[model samples]
Target: MQVQVKLFAFFREGRFIKEDKELPTDTTAGQVIDDLNIDREEVGVLMLNSRHCKFDTVLQEGDIYAIFPVIGGG
Candidate 1:
């Protein structure tokens, strides 16, 4: 299956802002994060097809997944 992935904030540094990735069936959001070498602690939000989703959420073909990093400010 092929899915679109979007990275936000620092997550995009030294990495692509967005890309289409080919994954195996039954792949999870957490698996994508792992493939990107992103720490689970750094992930603030996970969205699938514009809806909030959990790290364990199973991804589907042609799904759009966006990952936002934890933000810190005063």
Candidate 2:
């Protein structure tokens, strides 16, 4: 199955801003992060199809997934 992945903020460093990725069925958001060598602790948000989701959220074919890194400000 294919899914659209969008990386935000520092998450796009050395990576792509957005791209269509070929993934296995039932792949979890966490799995994709792991595959990209992203640290779970650094992940600030996960969105599936524009809705807030978790790392364990299962990704479906043609789904749009977005990842954001923790942002700090005062």
Candidate 3:
């Protein structure tokens, strides 16, 4: 199975390019990030097709996902 992953802000700054990634069956968003050497702690929100998702959220083939960093208060 394959899924599209979009990394933003801090992630992109970390050298991650937004691209379609091939994920194995039963793989979760966290797993994909882990495989890519990304730390889940750095990501504030996770979305699957624009819906809030968790790290444990299992990925489906052809699914689109976006990850964003958390902004702190002034």
Candidate 4:
């Protein structure tokens, strides 16, 4: 399956860039994230089809998933 993976904030500065990930049919959102070796706290949100979902959410092929970093305000 072809899933689009995105990285934001400092993650983008690390070992991440625009790329496509391949996984089994039952792959969860969390698995893909972990494969990137990204720090969990660094991610603020996970959106699939514009709706926010948890990492356990099962990823569907051809879905436009966006992972953004946590934004903090003083």
Best by TM-score: 2
Tens-place lDDT digits, model 3, residues 1-74: 87889987778875666788776799988887787677878879899988999999998988998888786667
CA lDDT, candidate 1, residue 8? 94
> Per-residue lDDT tens digits of candidate 1, residues 1-74?
99999999999999999999999999999999998999999899899999999999999999999999977679
Give the Å error, residue 62, model 4.
Answer: 0.8
lDDT digits (tens) for residues 1-74 of candidate 4: 88888776777886676678777988888887787787777779988878998889999888777788887779
Model 2, 1-74: lDDT tens per residue?
99999999998999999999999899999999999999999999899999999999999999999999987789
What TM-score would every model get versus the actual structure?
0.93, 0.94, 0.85, 0.83
Report residue 55 deviation for candidate 1 (angstroms): 0.8
Task: Work out candidate 3's RMSD over C-alphas.
Answer: 2.0
Question: Over all chains combined, what TM-score does candidate 1 have?
Answer: 0.93
Full candidate order by TM-score, most accurate first: 2, 1, 3, 4
Residue 30 alpha-carbon offset, candidate 3, angstroms: 0.7
Candidate 2 backbone overlaps, count: 0
lDDT, candidate 2, at 62: 92
Name the runs in model 2 displaced over 4 angstroms.
72-74
